[model samples]
Target: MDLQIIQNRIIEIRGQRVMLDFHLAELYEVETKVLKQAVRRNIERFPEDFMFELTKSELDKLRSQTVTFDWKPTTYAPFVFTEQGVAMLSSVLKSKKAIRVNVEIIRAFVQLRKLAIQNSEIIHRIDEMEKKYDKQFKEVFTALRYLIHPPEKERRRIGYKK
Candidate 1:
């Protein structure tokens, strides 16, 4: 599977990056219900940080804000699994397909982390350059503008010296 495909499924929720169970089920080629059942059977493996159920309102918010969410209305709030939770799934789901998909999913998560770090470093460098150049450029431009159109002479004090 393309890492980009997996990455696109990842979403930031509750201040952590997570993948919804349905998306993972689709990736694993299993029904969403079966996946949920497996997770419930291995609930101990998943802590609060590893997995959590969204509130009804939270799901609604996602549906409204993101075009990717085309979830039909359902009685149960869908569970979201974090990176660790996805890794833990490989153990519970012993099928070869599950294992393979899990590996790809883990890779996708790692790639995203790497990307975020790179972007942050890039932004920091950009900020440093801006700070270093802002004043110098301002002075240079001021000088150039002065030469191009020198400030108007003081108009002889407009007929009176205060």
Candidate 2:
């Protein structure tokens, strides 16, 4: 039920934050096969927008870019659950731990949103500062270039070199 544990379950793949099926299974205290079976049995509950399987290329990209524990090319593609699908998981996975973990996961999603918004603001400020100082920086660069590399007319003769 720890938020940190749920937050750690989130991963960035395909340029979006998502939870992989195996990680969700572990969090819900179910075997990966069991969780996949439940999802398969209740496919209607998960629409394409709510849940989708990662393509082989997408999976490969994730594997290449991200560090993982005990990861292998899965026989079946991993399912990615969006916010709505995460909520639906509670209904499909009925257990005390599931309920508790689901709540933590929801909170983690909200925290992620807040963090993203905060990061956007920070990036915006950085962009503004960069824009404001760009002219000054260019002038400084020009001045430094002149100091470091003088004109051919200003070159001094090397007395020792033949």
Candidate number with greatest lDDT:
1
Per residue, candidate 1 scores C-alpha lDDT tens digits across 1-162 of 898899999999988999999899999999889999999998999999899999988988988768766686677889999999999989988999999999999999999999889977866765576578877676765565567558877544446666
Q: How accurate is candidate 2 locally (lDDT)?
A: 0.82
Q: What's the distance in Å from true for residue 137, model 1?
A: 4.8
Misplaced by over 4 Å in model 2 are 129-162
Candidate 1 clashing pairs, residues 3+ apart or interchain:
none
TM-score of each model, in listed order: 0.81, 0.74
Against the true structure, candidate 1 reaches a TM-score of: 0.81
lDDT of every predicted structure (CA atoms) = 0.87, 0.82
State the lDDT at 116 in candidate 2: 86
